[model samples]
Structures are given as C-alpha cells and as structure tokens.
Target: MTDLLARHRAVLPSWMPLYYAEPIEIVSGSGRRVTDAAGRIYLDFFGGVLTTMVGYDVPEVREAVERQLRSGVAHTSTLYLIRQQVELAEKIARVSGIPDARVFFTNSGTEANEAALLVATNYRRSNQVLAVRNSYHGRSYAAMGVTGNRGWSASTLNPLNVSYLHSGDRLRGLFRHLSDADHIEAAAEDLREVLATQTAGEVACLIAEPIQGVGGFVHAPDGLFAALHKVLDERGILFISDEVQTGWGRTGDHFWGYQAHGVTPDLLTFAKGIGNGFALAGVVGRAEVLDSVEAVSFSTFGGNPISTAAGNAVLDYVLEHDLQANARRVGAILRDGLRAAAGRYPIVAEVRGRGLMLAVEFVRPGTVEPDPAVTTRVFEECRARGLLVGKGGLYGNAVRMGPPLTLTEDEAREGLEILVASIATVSAGEAVACGVSA
Candidate 1:
C-alpha cells in the first residue's frame, strides 16, 4: 500500500468502505474523466457517489463558488438573511411541486433527513416511522434506524420505532412470482398490515427512496409508492421521499423520482448532485409541515453563501443545458447496452435502474445466488482497465454506475465497452490479481 493508504488505514475507521484492492487517490477531474495519483486517467462512472451532477470542473459552478469566495462574507449563520440562500430556496420550492412549499437547508443528506424526521415526529406527535425493505436513507442515528439494508445499518438501536415495509424489489421478495400489478397490491397490503399491527395506527411518517441508492440502485415498480400513499393519507401519516440519490434528474424519466410514482410527498429531502459536489442538502415541504418545529433550530453552516451560490449556478446550468433530457436519452442508450451485455454474460444475472443511475447484478451462472467473489474480481478488472464504477447490495454483488447527467453519447458508449470487456475478462477467468493484501 502507498504511504497515504497506510495513513488512511491508521486514522480512518475500519468500517469505512474503500473501493479497489489497492485504493487509488484521485488528483483531478474534468467532465466525466478523472486522473489518479499515478497520472492514470479513468472514466468516472460513479460520479463521486452521484454528487458531481454537472461533471467535475464545471466552469459555471467554479465561477459561482469563486465569486462567492471573493466576496467579503462567507459564514452567515441561519439567523441572518442571505440572498443566495433565499434565491436557491425559491428555485427549489418552485420545482419541488409541494404547494406553498418551505425549505430548510442542511449541510448533508444525513442532516437533512434528520431534520425531516424531527419535523415529522413533532407534527404527528408520534415516534413511529415506516420504512421500506432494502432501503438506505443516511448514516445518522435516526437515518440508520430507518435503513433496511443490513450491510449499511451499523447498529440495531434506534431513536424511533421503525417498521419495515415491502418495497418494489420483486426479485427476492415474497411476491417475486406475482405480476407487477399484483406485486404492488401485495406490497401495499403488507404496508397496511405493518401500520395496523406494528404501530399505534398514528405513525409519524413513511420514509423511502424512490430508487434505493446504496441498495444497488434497486427501484420498485412504477406507482408502488402512490399506492402506499393512499394508505398513509388515510392514516394521516406524512410521506418523506428521500431523494438524496434519485433527485436532480438522475432517473431520466422524471425530474424527481417521486414523480414517476405520481405522488406528492409531504416532505422531501435532497442532496447529492444539487450543489455539484458542494455540501448542500435540504428538506422541502408544505409551509405548515415545515413550520411545525416549535423550538428555534438553526444550521451553523447549512445554506452557506458559497454553497448556495454553487447550487444556483448548477440549477441554472441544468435548466439551460437540459441535462435532464440528456440523462434520459443517454441513460436509455447505456441501459440498452448493459441489457445487451447481460444477454451475453451468464454471470450478469440482472440489469436494473433508471436513467444514469444503473446497476448490473452478478450471480452464479444459471442460478440466482449472489456471487460476491466474482463481483470483486470484475470490479478489479474494470479498475485495471481504467474504468471506475461502484459496488453495493446486501451481498455486495452488484456493480453500480451513475455517471454525470452530462455524460455524452460517445463517452457512454466507450464506458460501456470497457465495462463489458472487464466483465468478459473476469468471467473467462483471465483476470489478474488486483494486488489486494491482507
């Protein structure tokens, strides 16, 4: 290992996951490509965990942030009025689809979700929350409590009582054999049962990710959440859409993933791609719901002028360039290419995800068993070939790709070619060791 890697191991927590057998240090990036410490250029399919929405080294975002830095003001606590913060909030509220929307900004997705939970429990006067199976919200105590994926959840202790409901993952669920419509009905029924038997019938809210990010980009059938919304509406439970990964037009089909389900959530949390790598996240909801917090609350560095300036620029670029439509067009191309590769590779058990956030699942040939060993080998193979991707799943057997929404057709094709070749190399048992040491 490099000296830096050794130092990282010595200082960072052991549970913090690192990619590659030999972790690489990225030095710089432009567009969808990044250069590592060794000066090797690789196509960045992971997009810094889907945070670099407009791509790295975007001039617009850079200029905005630089301008903010040049200004005499930097840290204005939430107590003071900030113009950039107000402008970004107005833009977010307008696009959020919530009637009479109000926004509360936070420094990260975890904090944003925590604030949402605070508002929700306080508003409903209940500490009971409903979450989806195989979902990941954030890393805070409250966020991790609602997370269903065992690999990501670090503890069993929780601040609130959380009940897991069946989400739209039809592959391994109890209703896997049922039709799509039937599966939705079954999941909705399962949710109703949970609400009836698991809680006091007055739950705070239901938190969900339209597409499970850390769960390998797993998404439910369309309209699944809408169906469950009916149940929550009747019970007076709020709906919190965790769009940390699915927001900012990454899904291609809709600007917001919840739009695909045809439901307007009572609360929505956004991060990862909004500020184009800056620490910017927030909760948007109806004015009344946001105003339910009786105590005076403030975020020290949330919605800072610099970050808000970057957000405004990012939003402006997204609108002017129509990156959402680009995501749809290029995402369809990449998805088709991956599906074609799945047809050719026996180890590729399934290809899933919408728009740019996509995943390829690795399994034993002709069987449904997850093959994490082969998945690791394939990951190293891709790394050796100068292609960087991501990995996630309950079993750690899925390869995830969420390239920048600004990814071009040619770049998508090139990256797909490299991915398919890497998979082929690993499947043929011709892959070399990736220098992993214990």
Candidate 2:
C-alpha cells in the first residue's frame, strides 16, 4: 500500500503544489508526532495548521468518539433534537464570555465563514463588507471573495460586495500596513469617511481576523479596532471576528483572540482546535443578530452527534487540564526561544506573534527583500531533522510554528533546537535531507 501511494504521487509533476504537501506521505500520528510511510517520525509543530490543539489522536477524544459511535447516532439532520450539540454550543459560548450568542455549526472553517457572510448580508439587507487586506477567510467562492491573499486565491475582479481596508504603515516590513497613535486616528477617520459616502444602510458588517492568520500573523495596530469599533457601532454595522485560526487557546493568554484587544464581536466564527482534529466549524453571534435570520439559516452536517461529542471531550479536556494556562506557559517559552534564535541569525529578520501562534520572518541577510528561496531551504532542512512547521505571510517567507497547546516546555525547546539548527545549516548552504520545493 505504501509503495502504491508512492507510485501514485510519482506520476504527478513535482511542481504540482498539493497545498503545502512536501513530497512525503504520512501513515500515522500520535501525541504531536507523525510517522511517515517510510517509518520516519517527525514532531508536528504546525499542529495541522493550528487545528490540532489537543495533540494527535488524543485518547480522550478517541474515547469520546468511540462512545458516540456505540450509541448508534453519529450524523443527524439539524431538524431533529441533538443534546450534544446544545451542550457543545453552551460550552463554547460560556468560554467565549458571549452569553447572548447563538451557535451555527458547519463542516469546516470556510463553510463557517460562508454561513457568516450569508447571515450578515441577508439578515441586514446590506451589500458591502469591509475586511482587512492580507486577511485570509476561507477558500469557498463567497468566503474567498472576502479573503485578500492574491497568491492563495484567484483575483477575478468581479463586482463582489466585499471591500478591504489596507493597513497604513509597515511595522518594520516584517509586518505591513500597521498603525501608530496618529495613524489609528487617521485610519478610523478614513473608514468613517468611506462609510459616510456609501449609500445609507448598505454596509452589512466589518469583518476582521482578531489576529490576521495567513496575513503573516499580524496583530491589529494598537487602538485600531477600539477606535474603528466606535465608528462601526455608531453606524450600527456588525463586527465579525473570524477566530477560525486564533480561537480555542492558540493565543495562550486568551481563550478568544479578540479578548486580547478587549472587543466583543457581534458575530464570531470558530473551527480548527475546537474539534482538535475532528471535522467541525461554528458561527456564534448575538441572539438578536442570530434571531434576525434564524428562520432562513440552515446546515445539514452542522452539528453532528459524533462531532459534538468530540468537541465536548475536547472542551472537557481543555478545562480539566487548564490547557489555556498551558498554552500561555509554553507559548512564552516558544516566543523567547524563537526570538533569541532570530536575534542570533541575520537571515531571520523578525520573530513575531503572541502566544503559541508565532512566526519567524526570513529576509535577505542585510536587506528587507523577502527571501523565499532561503525559507524553502530552511523548511526542507527542518523536515530532515524530524521537525514539522508551516509557512505564511504575504511573501511566503515566514516560518510559522503553532504547536499543540499540550506541548511541554522540554518538547517546545526540542522543536526550537531543531528549527535553530535547520536555519543555521540552510544559511550556510548545506544540503538538507529529503529536499522539497515550496
């Protein structure tokens, strides 16, 4: 079977990008480690793009899924009663501190965003949605329309209702379009002016990622959202927080990324770590906002018994173990280690992000030009040394590391050592094992 899978991949062109696949096939995973078909084990710092919050194949999650399977009820229509779904929704809402919120489940993050767009536009009868440039929402047509990454999505330039607000100044170029004190006032004023010029009651929502995930993990400018939120609130515009990537304790200090900014979104979306690997996504919003479209909104596999069971188990484990506290502890260690490594290496331009959701920017040794080639080399070297990471940022030169919240200090240090060595070797132009292209 392994040989057959290898042969199948061999027939495909090497240049064919399989959405970050790196010429390797995995056979199994357990507890932050994956075993490739060749029996090579690797530490998975990427956490399946920060979705595997509880680590790979956690026994608690497995046991919950198995228990649900034995009950002869897994997937079910939303038309019927599902106790687990309600319980899961309550748990998520309680943790999020948004009491007057309703939860709508979906199969993935993109689907969650799709439902949000529908709810925001249709319920309010508005035509415009303002998002951040370089923000990533999802890949479906409507969700893709809101996402601002040009390389990830094709720019059809159709008459979509969504418009984007660009960040004002670059924060040292490692990050972009950031705002300072004066810039924050200017950006807020600019947005207010734009809203005033638009047709009355036309803008439905102003969507944003509390911490821009695929947009290079850029946090919003200081006081940017607080100032902007005032304008949106005055205009009765809904604030939507896309927490698909930053929710469920990936930010360490806060359960939800928006908490770091001290804002409560009218509508919030979540996926990834909420299920800890099981397929699930959700949209939580104010009761009034949700009630506006309750009669019209629908999803088939939104909140299945099995998925909700898994979600319940994930939440139980998180709270029981205080995983959010763990995330805070381990994240500090990771940030310090990576930042120190960055300070030591000239090739590493910046190490930025809060908590475990961190990234190291690769640049020209003495300049700000993005060094994608060097990044590609470093990724390959890291893979050879039994560590797995991810890449993002506008230029694809940021090495993103979002390990499971369950990772211990020792494990975090081990992963950092592997990354440090990989960067050092790649900087010296040494050959990396199991070479793969970006």
The lDDT leader among the candidates is: 1
- State the local distance difference test value for candidate 2: 0.81
Model 2: per-residue lDDT, tens digit, 301-420? 888898899999998998999888888898888888877777766778887787789888888776778888888878888898999898888888888888888998889889988988
lDDT of 1 by residue, 1-438 (tens): 399998998999998988888999999999999999999999999989999899999999999999989997888888999999999999999999899999999999999999999999999989999998899988999999999999888898899999998766656777778887998898889988887788884799999999999898888889988999999988899999999999988899898999999899999999879989999999999999999999989899999998999999999998889888999999998899989878877788889999999999998777888999999988888889888999998789999999999999999999889899988877766223433221
lDDT of 2 at 394: 80
The models' CA-based lDDT, in order, is 0.90, 0.81
Sum up the clashes in candidate 2.
1
For model 1, the superposed segments whose C-alpha errors exceed 4 Å read: 430-438
Worst 10 residues of 1 by lDDT: 429-438
Models 1 onward score TM values of: 0.97, 0.91
